[model samples]
Target chain A: EAGVTQFPSHSVIEKGQTVTLRCDPISGHDNLYWYRRVMGKEIKFLLHFVKESKQDESGMPNNRFLAERTGGTYSTLKVQPAELEDSGVYFCASSQPGRGSPLHFGNGTRLTVT
Target chain B: GESVGLHLPTLSVQEGDNSIINCAYSNSASDYFIWYKQESGKGPQFIIDIRSNMDKRQGQRVTVLLNKTVKHLSLQIAATQPGDSAVYFCAEKGISSASKIIFGSGTRLSIRP
Candidate 1:
């Protein structure tokens, strides 16, 4: 019943710092997705997780970013040595992996790198 | 990268009037298209969706029209209200069947009350 939930609605970190964003999808949802939207840019897909496996990670920007969904539950995205370009709102979404289940999105974690 | 772009970057509409937002997608293989509404400091919320087969689909107060020929998509809001003010993004689902939604640049809808 509860929608997808994300933690730390807003985060402020200095450049070259490490930050982790978390997302817990809906109950029984097997599909989870991560997206990032820079200022005045389109919402870019980062990766997707099906259960505990990484479904598609081709969208990952660089090696500094890592995503994991261990035990087939929640997922986390970690940014190491964050750069100025890594500053953006990170969004997590989940769906039932059906034809038209409609992805439920969290409020998003706005990571501001100063 | 595939560009699912909007015809107008922004649109202004008077309250109680109708508002139309347009988007053009490059991937002809994209079979599913959806429109999402995102308020400030929030994630995208699905408004309505249309498949490649149907030319038009209507929701409670929103309608999505898909023109596969031109690869164009449009969302029409009835009785536009100030509460509807937000950035509306048109997303196209890649034909992968996993329903990967790639978003557009988004259109900021401003309602003049």
Candidate 2:
């Protein structure tokens, strides 16, 4: 089976620009998640989707960030008016619904804001 | 992939030697833990995982040991090879959220020829 896939492996944008990152999860996977790693930091969770409903989104950084999972098949994360601090690797992961299922990750989209 | 940190702690091991990488997780409430290996320009790949109910789990030449009392975890690779060189991250699935894994700072494993 194909693993999780992310689009536009790298993106460069100016401050105040809008950028959208997309992720396609593995087939039949019900759980999708977003995480990011800023320079010199550990990967932090951003949000999660269980099908079309958001399971959790407490980790979202600010109001400028938004995420959507249409039809509960794929997900898109949008950053409006991106800032310099938004530069980082955005990773999307998915896993089967289970207590200990391992998450499959995508290569991630590297976002650079100047 | 983007470089996530300024300097990650590195472990250098000679080929054909056993290598051990350690991690300390913060949440005692975590019931499941995982180890991931990420090569340059690639996503993190799952290595192995251990549940809170167990102290040790083994997978193809790799072993993960968990010490719940001290909240420490370690990954041991037998007969380490050059291909094993990568950044290894330990993640915890806390009881706080559903399948939301939290990652550590990561350790870079360098193989010596």
Candidate 3:
């Protein structure tokens, strides 16, 4: 089985621009999660989707950032008017519905805002 | 505020030697713990995991030890090789499914030949 896959391995955008990152989890996985690591920081959780419904989104940094997993197959994260602080690595992971299933992660999308 | 943190930011070990990475977590209620290895330009890969019910779990050449008393966690790598060099992170699963997994700052393991 293929691992979680992310698109646009690297992205460079201007400070006020918008960017969208995509993630395709492994087949038959019902739990999807989004996390990020800023420069020299720990990887922090952003949100999670259990199928088409959002399981948790308390980690979302601000209103400019939005994430959706329509139909529960794949997910996307969009950042509007991206700021310099938004430069970091965005990672996506997935796991089975039940507990004890290890989370499978993608290579992640590196976003650079200048 | 719940936080998971490592004792060291970097560790250098000679090839063929053993390496131990330590992490301290603030949440005593965390029931599950995991260790992940991340290489450059890649996402974290699951190395090993141990539930709160067990004190130690071993896999291949790696071992995870969980100490609930002090809320401490450690990963031991046997006969460390150059290929084992990477950032190793210790994460904790929160109390509920809605609680996202919290990761530590990570320890960069460097193998010196």
Candidate 4:
């Protein structure tokens, strides 16, 4: 079976520009999650999607960040007017619908804002 | 604010020796604890997990010990091999936090052959 896959393994953009990261979850998985890790920091949750519906988004940093999971198959995270502090590695994970299911993660997209 | 942290930033161990990594969490409400391994250029992979109800759980060659009173967690790897070199992270999930899992700064493990 194919694992979760992310697009544009690495991205570089100027400050104040817009960037979008994409994630394709494993097949038959209903739960998708987004996470980010800045330099020298632990990975933090961004949001979660359950079959096209937003399950939890409290971890989203600010209004400039937007995440959408259309049709529940894939997810995209968009950051507008990106700031230097927005540079980090964005990871996507998916799991079966269960309380203790393990999450399978992608290689992640490394975004560098200059 | 709730947070999880590791005791050391890095560890160097001899091959075939056991390696232990420690972690501390501030949230007493957290009921589920997990360990993940991340190699360069890859995302975290699940290692093992233990619930608050259990003090210890063992996997193939890894063991996770959870101490609720001290809010401490530890992962023990037996016969540490070169392939085991990676960043190990300890994470906690609160009972009411839905699917959000809080992670700690990882401890990098380096094996000496």
Whose TM-score is greatest here? 3
What residue pairs clash in candidate 4, if any at all?
none
DockQ for every model comes to 0.69, 0.61, 0.76, 0.66
**Residue A64 lDDT in model 1?**
99
Sequence-dependent TM-score of model 1 = 0.97
**What pairs collide in candidate 1?**
none
Give the alpha carbon lDDT tens digit for every residue of B1-113 in model 1.
57799988899999999999999999988888899999998889989988888999999989999988888999999999999999999998876756578899999999997
Distance from true location, Cα of A17 in model 4, Å: 1.8
Pick by lDDT: which candidate is best?
Answer: 3
Docking class of 2: medium
Interface RMSD of 2: 1.9
CA lDDT, every model vs. true structure:
0.91, 0.89, 0.94, 0.93
Worst 10 residues of 4 chain B by lDDT: B93-102
Clashing pairs in model 3? none
| Model 3 error, position A15 (Å) | 0.6
Candidate 4 lDDT over residue span B53-97, tens digit each:
999999999999999999999999999999999999999887753
lDDT of 2 by residue, B1-113 (tens): 21122123888999999999888766668898899999888888999999899999999999999988988889999999999999999888865447578888889899999
Error of 1 at B80 (Å): 0.4
TM-score of each: 0.97, 0.94, 0.98, 0.96
Q: What residue runs in model 3 are displaced by over 4 Å at the alpha carbon?
A: none
- For model 2, name the residue pairs that clash: A40-B4, A40-B5
TM of chain B vs. native, candidate 1: 0.95
Error of model 3, residue B99, in angstroms: 2.5
